[model samples]
Target: MALLKGWRYGVFISGIVGLIGLAIYPVVIDPMLHTDKYKEVQKHNRAGVNQEAIQPGNMKVWSDPFGRK
Candidate 1:
């Protein structure tokens, strides 16, 4: 009764704390620990060599034998 209720409460609190930690980690810890990958991606994006060409009226069609188009 009481013991089960206390255990549930503890688990709930722990889950909330874990979620908060996960939310904070990407915003704070990740940038501090790993900066090289982000910088490289940013530089690549700025270089303008990875852009994809999209033409008007160009649509991809997939063949499906089991279902409708």
Candidate 2:
């Protein structure tokens, strides 16, 4: 195995620390601050309503066709 020296080792160590921070941020910090906002958004939405919101023509650019356009 090759050995790292000086600033190269610092860079390598910092990269590993950054990756660990990223993983922890989502699993810990994000949920604490954003969970309520997520639930509020979910209140107006539903799963398995895929033909519309989750798919094509559910967007505002499409015509509704039933005079709702």
Candidate 3:
């Protein structure tokens, strides 16, 4: 019974520490690692409305192919 109690206490402390680490990691670490991708996604979402007129991978995407430029 004493051994079981000690095991339970160990598990309980470990679980609390894991939760605290997870809570802090996102606020302190994830942003630094993921900011570029996050910003790119945001920029893409904002520019989605203009995509119809400017297809990707084309240098003269703004101008039509038939000498519109």
Candidate 4:
């Protein structure tokens, strides 16, 4: 029972640490690493453009010639 309790405690502590790291990352690491990318995204947003919008050339139209409807 002690071993099981220890394992559970370890898992709980590790989960808490992981959560803290995730919370810190966006506040600290993301701005430090991707500031330029964020700025470009903001610029596009201000210009009424969605960065995720697909371009025309990338569209795929599937035509099934061999499959029966």
Candidate 5:
């Protein structure tokens, strides 16, 4: 647009570049740099989920009280 010119154009272009970098950072850079750490965190999360899956209380969280599940 006419409003985007000179330094404004630089700012606009830089903003677009920043957005692209952000998208690529998560999808490409993170997997390349931190895949092992991410897998470890996922493993821990799954372990925690399985550990607390059968919550024991007056209100059951994941388990069926009548043993239907």
Candidate 6:
């Protein structure tokens, strides 16, 4: 009975560790490791919008919904 209980505890702790690893991997590890692909996707995702079209004025955010660029 004691040995069985110890294996259960070990399995539970290992599962918790695996969950924490999965959470950190995407946000931190993947970006640094695959920077070029990341940048390409980021640009593609922001296709229609101009981030700072007019720096000191009202045309800050512009978007054309129908166009990819």
Q: Which one is best on TM-score?
A: 6
User: What lDDT, from 0 to 1, does candidate 4 have?
Assistant: 0.70
Query: In every candidate, how many clashes are there?
Result: 0, 0, 0, 0, 0, 0
Off by over 4 Å in 6: 1-4, 45-53, 56-69
Candidate 6 lDDT at 7 equals 77
- lDDT: worst 10-residue window of model 2: 60-69
lDDT of 5: 0.70
Better of 4 and 6 by lDDT: 6
Q: List the residue pairs that clash in candidate 6.
A: none
State the number of backbone clashes in model 4: 0
lDDT per model, in order? 0.68, 0.69, 0.69, 0.70, 0.70, 0.74
Model 6 clash tally, residue pairs: 0
In terms of lDDT, which candidate is strongest? Answer: 6
Q: What is the alpha-carbon lDDT for the whole of candidate 6?
A: 0.74
| Residue 6 miss distance in model 2 (angstroms) | 0.5
**Per-residue lDDT value at 63 in model 3:** 36
User: Which lDDT value does model 1 have at 42?
Assistant: 65
What is the C-alpha lDDT profile of model 2 across 1-69, one tens digit per residue?
889999999999999999999989988888667877666666566444544554555455433222332
Q: What are the per-residue Cα lDDT tens digits for candidate 4 across 1-69?
A: 355477788998899999999999999999777777776776676586543464466665433223358
Residue pairs that clash (backbone atoms under 3 angstroms), model 5 = none
lDDT by residue (6-49, candidate 6, tens digit) is: 77888988999999999999998897778777767877998886
What does candidate 3's lDDT look like per residue over 36-64, in tens digits? 76666766766746755556575553532
Which 10-residue window in model 4 sums to the lowest lDDT?
A: 59-68
Write one digit per residue (lDDT tens) for candidate 1, span 14-66: 99999999999999999767877676776776575423344335555432223
Cα-based TM-score, every candidate: 0.49, 0.48, 0.43, 0.45, 0.49, 0.52
